[model samples]
Target: MDTAERTLIDPTHFREVMGHYPTGVAVVTGVVDGEPVGMVVGTFSSVSMDPPLVAFMPQVGSRTWDRLTLAPALCVNVLAHDQLELCRTMAVPRPDKFDGVDWVPSTLGAPVLTDAVAHVHCRQQSVVEAGDHWIVLCAVEGMEVTRPATPLLFFQGGYGGFSPAGMAAKADAELITAVRLGDRARPQVERLASRLECEAAALVAISPDELTTAVSAYGGSATMVEPLGQRVPLIPPIGEAYVAGAAPEVVERWLAKVGPNEPGLVECYRSRLAAVAERGVALSMVGPGARSDYQRLHEALAEYASGELTPARERAVRTVLAQTRHFFDELDVLPDETYDVGAVVVPVHGPDGRVAMVLRITQLPAGMPGRVVNGWIEELRTAAGCVERDLVGRGAQQASDYRDWWEADFPM
Candidate 1:
C-alpha cells in the first residue's frame, strides 16, 4: 500500500467506525459566575498516572466548554448504569440544565454530582488542537470511585449497561422482548401490590432456563422486595408456576436440570407442574417453624444472582433450591395445616394464549390460614386477568419481534 494511493478518511466513516467501541459516560461540572455548569462527554480518559492527568475532547467551538474552562476547577462525574436521564440533561446546552440536579461543591469549589459512580477534581493544565476538536488536559487534584457500580456505557450510538460474562447470561433480543412484556404488565402489578399489601412483581422468561423480574412494586408494609431485573432460575419446584404451562422443549429442559435424580424426585416435580397448571395458581407454603429453611433458600438464590459463584458453589445453590420441594407440594393442604405462605404466583396469558409473564406476590403476612391464602391467590388471578385483557386490547402478541434492533439492521 502506497501513501499516494490512500483515500482521504471521511468524517462519517470515522465516527461510525469509532462508535463500535464502548465508552464510559461522564459529566464535567463546575461553578461559573455563581451558577452550576456541566457538559456530558464520552471522551473522558486518563492521560498519565505518574502526574495524575486526565483528558477529554470537546468540539473546538463548544460554548459549554468555553464557559467551563473559565471556572477555577472542574469535577468530572462518572455516571452509573442507572443515570441515563441525567446524562441527557447534561448533554444539552442550557442555563437551567442544573435546575433539579443534586450536587455539592468539592474542596476546590467544583460541583460534584452526589450519586455519580465517581468524581475527579482537577485544574486545567493544557489544551491541544485536534482536527475539529480540542483535547483539553487537566492535572488531577483528587479522585475517587464514589459509588462502585457498573458504569454507564455508550456503544453504537445508544446507551446500555454492563453484565458480567461469567454470571447470569442474557441474550439482547430476548431481554428486549422480556422488558416489553413487563412494561405492559406494570399497571396491573402495581395495583395488585397496593391492594394485597405485599410485594408484587411480573416475571418474564428472558431465557429458556431463567426468568427475570422485570417489573416490581413494594407496597403496604412490605419489608423485602426482589430487585427489578432479578434473575430467578426456572428450575423445578422453584418456578413451577412458569414451567407448568411452558412449551414442551422448555419444560423438558427445565426438568433435566433437577439437582438429584432421586427415584421419584423427577416424577414429583412433574406431578407438581401438572397440579400448578390445573390449579391455575401455584402456592408455596412455609409451614410453621420453617423460617430458617426458607432463609437458607433465599440466601442461596442471592448468591446465585451475584454472578460471582464458583461451579461448586452454584451446585450447592441448586441443591438448596431442590430441597425446597416440600414447600411446593401444596396442591391439597388440609384445613388443619396452618400455612406460612412464602409466595403466590399466577400466569398472565398473551393474545396468542401463551404464558407471556407471571404475576407474583411475596413478603406476605406469615402464619396465614389456607382460607386467607386462597383469597390472596384469587386477588392475584383477577389482576392477571386484567393484564391479559389489556395485552389483547393493545394487540400484543406472545412474542414481539426485536431482531432488527438487536441484530443491528438499520434502514435509514
Candidate 2:
C-alpha cells in the first residue's frame, strides 16, 4: 500500500490487523535507584546475530521506560504460560510490582524474573525514535534458557500457548490411521473388563456431540450395553467424561441438544465439570429406587441407537440423560462415601492435552465395596495413562521424522 493509503488506516484497524500475528511475551527488567523495576512488552525481538543485538519498542510517554533506560543493563525475561499474572503485574502502573514476585539479580545487576522460560542479559547499545515509540537496542552479553515449558503467547488480544502444528497434525493423522486399520484399544479394554468383571468400552469422539465405540468387551457374567461401532450422542451417563474437558464451544453445542438451560442447571453442569476435573473420572451410580430409571435409560438408549425413537420419546430420553448427567460429578467431592451401584468413565489425554478417548465400565454390581471401586478407578486411570503415553510417543516419533525430512529438503 502507498504511504497515503497506509496513513488512512485507523488505529483500531491497524491494531486488529497486526494482532493476528502471535507474539511471545516478555518482561524487561532493570534496577533503578537500587530497586527492581520492570515493564511488560510484546514487541521484544532479536535484531542482529553477529553483533548479538536485541531490540524492544516502548511507548514514547512510558514512564517505566524513561526510568528503565537510565539503568546500565537490562534483562529480558521470557514469560512462561503460567506467568501470565506476573506479566499483568508488570504491565499495570504500580509502586511495588515486585513485592511478592521472586527474582534474583543478573550478572549486570538487572533483576532476572524467576521461573521464566529464558532470560537474556544485555547492555544498553543505542536508542532511536520510531513514530510514537522508542526503539531501544541492546547488546546481548549473556542468555540462558531456564525452563522447557511452553512460552506465553499473545494473540488477537488474548493469552494462549502454542503446540507444534506439525506434531498435532501428525497425531490426528495417526489416530485416524489406527482407526482405519482397525487397531482399536480392544486388548486394553478387554483386559480391564475381565479384571473388573464388568462391561468395558473404548469410545472415540468423532465430534463434540457424537462418539463411536471403537471396541467393547463384556465380562462372562456382565451385561452387554454397547457394541463395537455403536455411535451414541455425547450425553450424560456415558459421554460426560468426554465432554468435561472439551472446549467451551463444543460443550455449548452438546448442551444445546440436552436441556437444563436454566441458570441453575448451567451451574449444576459447571459444578459437575469441576468434579470431573478434580476426580479424573465420571460416574453414574444407581442410587436407591433408581433401578427403574436406569431401565428406562437403557430402553431410551437402545431406541436412540436404532433410530426408532419418536420425537417425543427422544425429548424424554434427553431429559432423563440431563438429569443424570452429573450423577458422578460429586463422587470426587465425597470420596469417603460409598455408592451401591454405578459406572465409571475416564478420559485418556493425547499430547495436546485433549480427550483422545474415553474408557468406560458400566453396570457395577450393587453393594460393591468402596475400596474395590477405588481400586477399579485407579486401574482405569493407569490404563488410560498407558494409552496416552503410547500416543504421545508415536506423535513424538512422527514429529522427529518430519523434522528430519524438512531439514534435508531445506537446509538452514
Candidate 3:
C-alpha cells in the first residue's frame, strides 16, 4: 500500500490518537526593535549536552517565529505547572505577548522569561524547514536557573503529566548543600543561613496556605505557594556566585559576616521573600547558599514525596533520623572520631588532563583530635611535594588539618 493511501486516517480521528503523548510547554523568545518578543511552543527540547544545544519546532505560519529569525540568538523558557495561563496566552499570536509577562533580555539580545523553571539562552546555530514547521536549533552560550521545580507539561489534546508524580533532574552542587542541612542545626538556622549565605524557608509539607503561613512565622514570606510541591528559595549574588565559581575566600568571608543574628542575612532573606510574594511558589531557601541548596532540597523532596515511602523504608529513615537527633543532642560530648571521620570531596582538574584527588583525611583508632590539627601537618608535607606516607599515618593528621581549614574558612 502506498504510504499516504494506506494511512488515510481522518484528521479528526488522528487528534484522538496523537493526544495520548504528553509534551512540555516552552516559550521561544528574542528581541526585536529593542523590545522583547516571544511565542510559546510545545515541542522545545534539549538536543545535546557536550556542546550545549536545544531545538524546537515553530509553525511555519507563526509570526513570532518570523520575528525570531531576525535575532542572532534566542532563549527557551521552560514553563512550570503553574504557568499554564502564561503558556496559553503566549501560544496564540498576540501583538503584545509581554503584556502580563515579566522578562529580561540576555547578552545576545534574547528575551529570557524571568524565573522560568529552567531557561537556556543561545545563539542561532542553524535552522531547517520541515514539512509544516521550521526546526529551530541553537548553540547554548549562557544559561541560568533561578530555582528547581516541576516543569509544566502539555500532551495529547490536553495538558497533563507523563508520570503521576513528575520528576526532574537537579544541579549536583545544590544536592551537597541539602546534605549539609541534614546536620539539623535548625536552632541556629538563621546563623547557619548566614554562614551558608542562605537559609531554607520551609513549612510542613502540606497545604499551600498552611505552608506559607508557617513560613511567614519563620521570617519567610510566601508567594505562589503550591499545595503539594517543592518550592525552593532564590538567593541572588550568592546563588549566582556558586555558578560563577567564586573564590573560596570570598565565599567564606560572606559566610562569616551573615547569619541569623546578623542584619545582612536576615535582610537578604526578607527581601527575596517579599519579591516572590504570592506569585508561583513560596518558601524558598533564600541567601547564604540559596542557588544550589534550594535546588537540591526541592529535587530530593519532590522525588521522595512523589513516591510512596514503604513501611520498611520509613522505618529505616526514622532510625537514621533518631540517630542523627541523638548525635546532635550529645554533639559536644561525642568523640572526635564521631564528629569527623569522612573525606572532604572536592572536584578539581589535575596534571593528568583529568580530575584527580589532591587530598583526603580519615579518622584513626588513636584518641588524638589529631584528625583536624595534625591533618594540616600532613597537608604541608604535600605542599613541598607528594610525601609517600601510609594511609593510616596520613589520614590521622590530614583529617585534623582539614577540620582546622574548614573552621578557619567557615567558622560556625
lDDT of 3 by residue, 1-412 (tens): 5566675778788877877767888888888777777888888888999889889998888788888788767888988766878888888777777887887777777877876778888888888998678888889998776645556777766775322211222333333333232122233323322322322222211110001101211222312322222322212222221211223443343343234455675455334323322211111112333335434433433434443333343334333322222111111222254232111111111222221112111121223353542343233223213211221243334333333443463332
Write down the TM-score for model 2. 0.50
The regions of model 3 sitting more than 4 angstroms off are 1-7, 161-412
**Model 3: how far residue 344 lies from native, Å:** 33
The TM-score values for the models, in the order shown, are 0.56, 0.50, 0.43
Q: Cα RMSDs of all predictions? A: 10.0, 21.1, 20.8
Give a tens-digit lDDT track for model 1, residues 111-222: 9997898999999999999877899999999999887666889999999877643245565566666777788888888898898889999988766667888888878899
lDDT of 1 at 281: 89
* Residue 77 CA displacement from its true place in model 3, Å: 0.4
Query: Relative to the true structure, how large is the alpha-carbon lDDT of every model?
Result: 0.81, 0.74, 0.45
Residue 283, model 2, lDDT: 73
List, residue by residue over 1-412, the lDDT tens digit for candidate 2.
Answer: 5566665768999899999999999999999999888999999999999989999999999999989998889999999988899999999988799999999999999999999989999988989998889999999999998975668999999998765321111224433533432234567788888887889887765444556677778886896667665557666545778878766765666555544456676666667776786778887778777777777777766755654343455566677776665455447423456676577889877565766678888866777667777888889998888777776775545333433443353232
